[model samples]
Target: MVFNRPKKRAIVESGDGGLGLGIATFIANGEDLGPIIRHSFESGKPEALMQNLRSIVKKKEVEIEELCRLHYEDFIFAVDELCGVLVDAR
Candidate 1:
């Protein structure tokens, strides 16, 4: 079996990691997240974020699967960690 490396995504600029801009830049990706944010906040449902992520990423099955294969561990860990933090704050 062979591994294909994912291209480096520049989600963080120097010194910005501590400022929370890394994830912001990663998710923004040239599109305004305002509507998604407002809707999810208004809906107040955890699935709102999941559904948005599904629509954005799952539409391309091949890429999605490959991405998940490569990134799922780290991604899921981040999600789980954030979930704990978010749930605690609620």
Candidate 2:
């Protein structure tokens, strides 16, 4: 019998008043998730990339005009999504 251990999840800090919150504050208010999004795209599977970007687009619930007005603030995220999806292809 083969026993496979579950993979460990990444540690994500979260808090409203602690250092976690402070970091979140900067990232959230900074209006930029570019670097991380790029990293995510470069690291993840391809299918995952597309799904992620599409999901982000859907979740934002904004029209193309609004997206453009926002200057594609979430574009990197979409790229990340695409990367993931492509990388995972067999």
Candidate 3:
């Protein structure tokens, strides 16, 4: 689905990975997320994007919670490892 952003004049897409997971994966892979998020808001789809993000978070909550139990550095490292997988996939 395409989310129209009138302000930024961009049409952000919720990609093929179901809902908006594709976009999230893209961002997690080191792509710049700020522009996409800003455009989503500018285009008036903040709630939609947020919902998708929340879903993604929920799916990862258990994993993230476990990571949090470790040291902060470990959590950061785990995140980096996850994102790195995406980058490698690309």
Candidate 4:
């Protein structure tokens, strides 16, 4: 049997390694996130939209190792919960 190379799962699995601006730029310029942000702004939820955007990039002085090891599904849940906090803050 032949072995295969490791797939580049980190980007797809970790919000593009958290340097997700390229993903954001692509989405903003392409068909996904950019459109969502546009719609959120048009819907008079600009503050909420900005809050969600901030939630995506929010960093702490110290990141918990548990968070650092989270898989994609878990990470999404964590971020969604975080967005909830930011939305509530508004």
Candidate 5:
């Protein structure tokens, strides 16, 4: 695990598949991702690449105008919300 923890936040913005806030910080705050991402792959540890990616998505989701919105709060880790109908396609 990257830093030995389960990161709860997301890295890519849900809005338009763009980089999230943590990305700038991740690149500018310290080690650049180019090396980190490359190292894991070159060292024969692909899992570490995914694990270390958590660092760039460590911030809480922010509301963005003119983009699709998701009810992150409604998410239940291991439970599925059973339903039989779809509505509100606005």
Candidate 6:
């Protein structure tokens, strides 16, 4: 008998306040967060990057709060719902 393991989802966290909030908001919106974050890190000026991140976080504050406060299962469900919206919109 073979047992299948669950695939691990990548959790992106910058550990800084604004950047982390921005990343979480992007994930909740079903937008890809990797490239922008990568560019920020490579820019060698995290403070400037964080200023931009804060703007994003402010723009999506409500969604960010809702997503952040969810339990793990609820969070997964919420993300799935957002993804469904993306699929339907395309």
Better of 3 and 4 by lDDT: 3
What ranking of all candidate models by TM-score puts the best one first?
Answer: 3, 4, 6, 5, 1, 2
Candidate 3's TM-score reads: 0.45
Across residues 2-67, which tens digit of lDDT does each residue of candidate 1 receive?
998655456443341131343345464564656545645675654645554665565567776888
Please provide, for model 6 over 1-90, each residue's C-alpha lDDT reduced to its tens digit, 9 standing for 90 to 100: 999865444455565532555455565557786766676778665676668667666877976677777666887899999999999999
Error of 1 at 2 (Å): 34
Q: What would the per-residue lDDT of candidate 4 be over residues 1-90, giving only the tens digit for each residue?
A: 999864333222223223234334443344356555565557666666566457545533134544666566888899999999999999
Q: What C-alpha lDDT values do all the predictions have?
A: 0.59, 0.52, 0.68, 0.53, 0.45, 0.67
Error of 2 at 31 (Å): 3.1
TM-score, every prediction: 0.28, 0.27, 0.45, 0.32, 0.30, 0.31
Top of the candidates by lDDT: 3
Best by TM-score: 3
Worst lDDT 10-window in candidate 6: 16-25
RMSD of each: 17.5, 19.6, 15.3, 18.2, 16.0, 15.8
lDDT of 5 by residue, 1-90 (tens): 457653444444324233334444455555356754564567676664454456434423232321224544454422344232223332
As for model 4, its CA RMSD to the true structure in angstroms is 18.2
Candidate 2 or 4, higher lDDT?
4
Model 6, position 55, has a per-residue lDDT of 69
Tens-place lDDT per residue, model 2, 1-90, is 999865443324433212222233334355355544554456554454345456556655666667687867588789988999999994
If ranked by lDDT, best first, what sequence of candidates would result?
3, 6, 1, 4, 2, 5
Please provide, for model 3 over 1-90, each residue's C-alpha lDDT reduced to its tens digit, 9 standing for 90 to 100. 998653322334555323365555654555566766786777787887788778777868977877768778977898999999999999
Q: Which regions in candidate 5 have their CA more than 4 angstroms from the true location?
A: 1-31, 55-90
Q: For candidate 4, give the lDDT.
A: 0.53
lDDT of 2 at 81: 89
